[model samples]
Target: MPSLMDTYIENREMVQPNHANNLDTVHGGNVMKWMDEVGAMSAIRFAGKSCVTARVDEMDFRRPVLVGDTAVIESYVYEAGETSVDVYLRAFRENPRTGERELTTESYFVYVGIDESGEPSPVPALTVESEEGERRQAEALDGLDA
Candidate 1:
């Protein structure tokens, strides 16, 4: 079994001109790409196998990350089935100098563990062992109801 905390991952991307739109803000697609990458990493950590994205739930962008800001993507596996790992992901716009951060986007993703032949593979059971891990799992479950 793998603890939910074991699947946690955080990645940061610098928002540069190439990753931004004409308005000088990070593009929505770029944000999604970052989130997806982080989410997949979490799922793979939990599954211990190659994982392929199966589905992405509704994603909402609450704010734009301006160019020069750091895009911080955090993800963790909150739940899992026989072969599917459910990951919760959130992205924040961080000011490197001030260390201030604000939520920019969030989404839920599903990834299926795969074998060498491309068939679904079983994943170890996920456990929420710590108080913080339990809280995070609960929060992700609560968001699913909203």
Candidate 2:
């Protein structure tokens, strides 16, 4: 089994585009795409198989990432079901040169594990041993309640 820390940042990306948006700032769709990709990677790492997005509870583009800036997204599994892992995803806009960052977006996603046959397969429960993990899990539950 991969260590807990390994599950946190495995196979992520730092996306930079021509600009944040076609008009001027970053595009909302591009941010969503990045979120989905990072979320899926967390699920696959935890489940040890392929996974697909089952649902996104909520996605909010609170801020815009400008062009030439870095869109750094972090994804980690916070909760799990028999065949699903709920991932907590957060994105920040960073100045590539200065390394300054600001929270730009966040969302909760649910993904289901798939076996070699491409059928839903069971995934282990999420194990939260640290305060941070617990807080993130709580945030996901609180999000569902809202």
Candidate 3:
């Protein structure tokens, strides 16, 4: 079994011109792609196998990440089923120099572990062992209703 915190992963991407729109804000698609990549990493960590995205719950863009800002993507496995891992992801726009950050986007993703032949494989159960892990799991579950 893997503890929920053990599956946590964070990635950062600079919002270069190529990744942004004419308005100078990072594109919505690019944000989603980053979230998916981080979420998959968390799932793979929990499952110890390759994982494919099964579903993406509603995504809400709270703010925009400017071209010069850093997009920090964070993800963790909060729950797991027989062959699936449920990950919660959050994206923040950060000012590199000041270290200030603001939430830009958030979503829930489900990934299914895969075997060598690409068939669904069983995943280890997720354990919320620490207070931080329990709090994160609670927050993710609560967010589902919003």
Model 1 local distance difference test score? 0.95
Against the unseen true structure, what C-alpha lDDT does each candidate score?
Answer: 0.95, 0.79, 0.95
lDDT at residue 14 of model 1 (Cα atoms) = 92
Error of 3 at 43 (Å): 0.3
| Runs in model 1 lying further than 4 Å from the true structure | none
Candidate 3 positional error at 25, Å: 0.3
Candidate 2 segments whose C-alpha is farther than 4 A from its true place: 1-6, 10-20
For model 3, which pairs clash?
none
- When 2 and 3 are scored with lDDT, the better candidate is 3
For candidate 2, write residues 44-139 as lDDT tens digits. 999998999999876888888777777899888877889988888888988888989888888888999998898999997667777876776677
Can you give the TM-score per candidate against the true fold? 0.98, 0.85, 0.98
Model 1: ten consecutive residues of lowest lDDT: 40-49
Cα RMSDs of all predictions? Answer: 0.6, 2.5, 0.6
User: What's the true lDDT of residue 10 in model 1?
Assistant: 90
The candidate 3 region of ten consecutive residues with least summed lDDT is 137-146
